[model samples]
Target: MLEQGDQIGFLIVSGTFLTAMMGTFIVAMVVLHRQRQVQNRQKIDNLKSEYEKTLLNIENEIQQETLTQVGRELHDNIGQLLSLAKLNLNSAKPEKQAEGKEFINQIIKEVRALSKTLNLDWVEEISMDDFIRQQLHRIESTGYCQTLFDSDQSFNELSKDSKLVMIRVIQECLNNAIKHASPDQIQIKIYKEDSLRKIDIIDNGRGFDTSIQSRGSGMTNLKKRMETIGGSILLSSVPGKGTHITLSLAF
Candidate 1:
């Protein structure tokens, strides 16, 4: 019903409208894509910031604990040793003077060992299993409770930051058991399952209800710390039975 010239004009108008719509769509898609990229970058930066902050906190706490132990050792162990050495050195006998020299040498060695723990380098120098063994030994030395350690001999290669966080968490667990659980025996086991390295801290003690949240934030903080290191913590306990905590990290 229309002339050819009019029909050609109609077609040109439709084509122009379609092209404009497509251009608008393409511009919108590009804008949206750039916005998503920016958002993702921000999210990644936030996560990195949070991780560094956590590591700093863990380092500070571990150093504080180390300082406390150093103070105790200097006062109780080294101080007493020095007094004994002085008494021996003051003696008229040659044997007593020799014993005094040996004590002085032993003190030097101990001081050197304690000095190593003053820095964060020890975290990298020591493996988690070795640290656990040392802690158990210290606890057993106290004669407060018995401790047992079992391992599958699986080697875990953890980063220094992760190792530091894990060490602090394990220390907190052991301290809590000694302070609150009043257990007669504490046991630690390290093993590997699938792609995960696991450490279990078990104690036959007065267990509490895990369902009811504690007034203190200790357990909650432990869980958060593990999460930060791409690890998880599972706790199970019965009032009369015992408490068991499993810490798992992916290799």
Candidate 2:
């Protein structure tokens, strides 16, 4: 019933309406997409902040542990050396002077070594392999277990954040082995495979079945810490045999 002009007018109006709707829809989509992107970025920032805070807490705990160990060394080892040196010097015997001097020099050396552990600055300067070896050596010196470290190459190529996470994981693994596993020997091996860096901690201890539930928080914490660093951990154990923990990180 409409004339030619009316049809053309109707078509133009319909076309304009559709074009406006499409333009509005596209603007809405863009806004929504931008909002989602902002939210995702905020989430990432929050996660990063949490990771940094946790890492800081770990560093503080490590520092306290180091200080405690330093105190023990001072009280038990260096103190005894100094006392012996003083007693030798007090005798006033010319022949014993050399022995007293040597003891004093030894005490000085021990003090210097302990001083380095008073702070965590050295951690930044040392390679991961060296750090692991140092930790194992501390355990070995306790006479509770025989510890060994083997590495295919140094892990200094890793980022500082990665190293911090790795250190915490290794420490936790070592402590767990020493405390619960009751292992006579503990060994750590570090190597690179393809684009991944792997660390294995093996202990010859009475291991528990993986199927069983554990009441301890150590394993849970270990898993969480590894996850924060974008790494993965695998645990294997056999009753009456031993336990092995492998930590893998992409380089």
Candidate 3:
């Protein structure tokens, strides 16, 4: 019904309107994409901040524990040794003086060993497996319980942060078993399953109900720390049987 020129003009107007609508849609999409990107970046930054804070806390705790051990050694071990050395050196006999020198040399060696633990550098030098074994040996030396360590001997390299957190968690578990569970035997097993490296701390002690909320924040704090390192912890316990804690980290 319209003339050719009129139809052409209508088409031109319709085309212009459609073009404007499409331009607005494209701009909206781009803005939305950018906004989402910003939000994601913020979330990542927040997580990273939390992780760094956790590492700092772990480092401080490790240093504190090291200091405590050093203090005890100074008072109980090294102080006693120094007193003996002084007694020997004050003696008139040459053999007694030689014994004093030997004691001094032994003291120097021990002091050097303890100094290594004063810094976080030792965390990098020690492997997780070695640390676990040392902890078990220490516990066994206490004569409170027997300890068994089984490993697949597979090498799984972890970041220093991960190793530190894992060490702290393992220490807590062992301490809890000793202080609360009163287990006769404690066992640690390390192995790889699929893509995950796993450590299992098992104690044949009276266990608590996992369903009940714990009055202490220890377990919750551990779970949060594991989350920061992208790891997981699974706890299983029965009232009379024992407690099994499985810690897993993906490599």
Candidate number achieving the greatest TM-score relative to the actual structure: 3
Residue pairs with clashing backbones, model 3: none
lDDT of 3 at 114: 87
Over the stretch 1-251, how does candidate 3's per-residue lDDT look in tens digits? Answer: 46988999999999999999999999999999999999999999999999999999989998999999999999999999999999999999999999999999999998999889889999889988899889999999989899999998553477788888998889888989998898999999999999988899999999999999999999888898989999999999999999999988887
lDDT of 3 at 69: 97
Model 1 sits at a Cα RMSD from the real structure of: 1.8
lDDT-wise, the better of 2 and 3 is: 3
The estimated TM-scores of all candidates read 0.92, 0.90, 0.94
User: lDDT for every model?
Assistant: 0.92, 0.88, 0.91
The per-residue C-alpha lDDT of model 1 at residue 101 equals 98
TM-score of 1: 0.92
| Residue 246 of model 3, lDDT score | 92
Clashing pairs in 1: none
Backbone clashes for every candidate come to 0, 0, 0
Clashes of 1: 0
Provide the lDDT at 236 for model 3.
97
lDDT of 1 by residue, 1-251 (tens): 46988999999999999999999999999999999999999998988898888888989888888899999999999999999999999999999999999999999998999999899998898888898999999999999999999988563477888888899999999999999899999999999899998999999999988888889989888988998889999999999778999999888
lDDT of 2 by residue, 105-160 (tens): 99989999899988877777889888888888888898989988889864767777
